[model samples]
Target: MASNRPAPEAPFIPAQRETETFGYGDHRTDEGPWEEWNPTEDSVRPVRGRHRVAKQRGGLARSSTVLGVGVIAAVGAGGMASAHTGKPPVSLSMPDLPSVGSLFDDSSASDAARATTPTLSKVGVTSADSDRSGNAGEALRNRIMAQAEQQQSKADSKATAAALADAEKQSAAAAAKAQKEAAAKAAAAKEKAEAAAKKKAEEERLAALAKEYKLPVVSYTITGTFGQPGSMWSSGYHTGLDFAAPTGTLIKAIHSGTITQAGWAGAYGYRTVLTLDDGTELWFCHQSSIGVSVGQKVSTGDVIGRVGATGNVTGPHLHLEVHPNGQATGIDPAPWLRDKGLNP
Candidate 1:
């Protein structure tokens, strides 16, 4: 098919140089005809490398081939530097090299070489795994600390509870002890008060009893005592006390009693017998005149008769006798009368 685009030109191929030349200026070949040097515009092609413009028709082809070979060599050297080092090509400083600017200007080739090279990270840098491990260790440490705190708190609470319980127990015991002491003290005081009151009541009763009792006689002269040896009675002794007094002298009863007999006896004269509440009898013999009748009640110091020589007496005198339980025998009335707060 017919197209509008231009056809590609053919590549130039160079023939080998037969002999080598080593001089700077032009020289003649060994067999070709001599040609004169010309400086006219039409004769001189641009001098490049080892090739020259020839007069024959194929001269352009030979020079083009040499140029192509030089270009291919430069491109290969630039590619190798870029591929191995991933940088600009080595340039001429002390050693000769291609220009660094020209090599770096190929941005697309530099990028391709960089992509093919193995990538590396900086040395001695941190990573995600190490960070995670550090975080886990810190968390574990915090958990351990928290658990220790909880255990310490529990121990403190137990100690406090035990101390409180002991305090309460001690307080209760102290309270009970105080109460018991108070009760004991109160009981002792009450007992002491009762004893004092009982003693006071006894004193009052004894004082009242002392006020009620009296002596038997006021003023009496004892002439003869009981159990005295005298020739005054048939028993050959004085059986009773003799109160010597004038005739018609008032004679009083010894104590409160009932008059059981008040009449004349056989041997002498009138006699009066008084019986007390406890069955004791008092005989007032030798009374001249009897003032009380039989079956009469009399008090202490009441007039019962008058003193007279009525019984077997020497003169006008009163003979007093006492009998316990109204028996025939008699005791001395002196001590009996003194027992009731009397000295006589």
Candidate 2:
């Protein structure tokens, strides 16, 4: 709190002031007449209210005066040094004064106040500035971590997609390969089935032919077939089928035909020429004996002659030849017999 009381007057008079006589007992000197003075509350004008200073005891008055003088001198020196060096002046904050009770009582309150006061260490930095810098660094670190995680996620996704695509391609290729294999197997199966069906049809045709015609010689071994290459035959190759059997094996007519010629024919001894109604001729050569005359009508399976080795032959066998349409040349009699449903 503030006080309205005036400051106390100085006890000593100023040298510049003119000498004056006081009502107390006076003494005269060359300079002036002075009176012995003692200050009391009435003369000093005591301070009023909360702003009043307590009376100093012991050596406290001298100590307080010295401390105040030292503080003022230090502050003035620091300000002058800053000005001379062309540097900014540092701000000094004074600690709050102790309460009146502390000054009047013990020094414990003053010591406590000094301990709690804040002290500045750096010129321009404060606790709040440091806190802001720490916050910024933490934010930057967090952002870097987040970016790393995001990049890793993207890489993982790409890898997964690539793997999936590769798997799909492999699956597609496998399916295509299977399909191709299946088609090849189907084609092979179809070809096999067609071949089997054709063979069966040929067998059925031969069976039907067997019912209509008979073989020329029964219980006989086919010693020679037509078109066999051998020097023993008169032509370059054999021209007829030879059925070997014992001499006098009954020779029968192969089909219903007329005996066009029945006589010995030179090289084809004791031959008989049977002419079919369609002019196809069958020659039965190397006969032991002829049973039919020329111009005779013979039915199928009739006795025609006997087996012989009368001609140019190595054994007893019947040699049969066929000529289509009375041509001089002959065809393979095996095929002709097959045409008449015989397997000779």
- What are the runs in model 1 whose C-alpha is more than 4 Å off? 1-217
lDDT of 2 by residue, 169-276 (tens): 999999999999999999999999998998788778767656546788888999998899998778878888999999999999888899999999987889999999
- Superposed model 2: Cα runs more than 4 Å off: 1-132, 226-232, 247-264, 270-282, 288-306, 322-344
Over 232-329, each residue of candidate 1 has an lDDT whose tens digit, in order, gives 57888878777777788888877788999989996547999999999999888888888999899998778888888865667887777879999998
The Cα local distance difference test for each model comes to 0.65, 0.74
TM-score of structure candidate 1:
0.39
